[model samples]
Target: MSVTAVNDVNFATQIRKEGATLVEFGASWCPPCKVLLPILDELSEQHGEKLRILKVDCDESPATASQFGVMSMPTVIVFHNGEPVEKLIGLRPKSVYENVLAKYS
Candidate 1:
């Protein structure tokens, strides 16, 4: 499956029960978020079986955004077995993401 979209209602359950998850906190209006989408989508397709990439719209899920202390858009955090393993703030090269996935995937 492609990346999952998360919200406040499903956030906890998803992370706690889903095994492993990578979440991106972003907003539709943010330019960098927009730019990052295609890259993430491509990565998701490239690593479909190895990773579970997810997104949370900060505008729709304020509580989740606050819980993670997401002060910026395009915050990419990788979680394994309900714990965060790595985080990348702002825009980044796709290679960086691929490398991280290779480790935990």
Candidate 2:
């Protein structure tokens, strides 16, 4: 299960119609964002049917970034039923992500 790339085009539908949506706001040039990418991929694979990970390229979609109020790189926002429920900024351990998500899952 690979992380899906979200944009202004599909952001609304994807977040609104999902079981659980984890949106990663990142840029390809950011180092920390790069590090978080694999972790997200692994999580996506592990939680295949239960979770949906969406990657948003901040540089490519400034509107979505601004709408989400993502001022920094590697910002991760988890949504349930079209509303944001959790937000994490910067890099974090895989366990931390897993633990937090376990509550929602």
Candidate 3:
């Protein structure tokens, strides 16, 4: 499936579902977040079997972001077995993302 959008209300349930999860804590208007969308979609297609990708709009889910101590606009957190395993902040090369997800996926 494509990347799923999770909000404040569904964050807990979604992250706890199962398997490896990469969550993008971002805002709609953030340029870096916008850029990451297509990359994430494409990456999801390639890694969907091993990963469940989710996106959360920080603007709409302030409490959720705050809970994660997300001080940046595009904080990507990788969760496996219901616990956070890795985190990446700011923009980076696609290979950088693929490398991280590859490790956990």
Q: How many clashes in each candidate?
A: 0, 0, 0
Q: What digit string (tens of lDDT, one per residue) describes model 2 on residues 1-105?
A: 789898888877777354678899999999999999999999999998889899999989899999989999899998876678899989899998898788787
Instruction: Please list the C-alpha lDDT of all candidates, in the order they appear.
Output: 0.84, 0.88, 0.88
Worst 10 residues of 3 by lDDT: 11-20
lDDT of 3 by residue, 1-105 (tens): 789999989898887446789999999899999999898999889886788889999989999999889999799998987899898999778899899877776
- Segments in model 1 whose C-alpha atoms lie over 4 Å from true places: 16-19
Once model 1 is optimally superposed onto the true structure by TM-score, how far is the C-alpha of residue 72 displaced, in angstroms? 0.8
Per-model TM-score, in order, reads 0.89, 0.93, 0.93
TM-score of 2: 0.93
State the TM-score for model 3. 0.93
Tens digits of per-residue lDDT for model 1, 36-76: 88888898788776667789999999999998889999999
Which candidate, 1 or 2, would have the higher TM-score against the true structure? 2
Clashing pairs in 2: none
Task: Measure candidate 1: CA RMSD.
Answer: 1.6
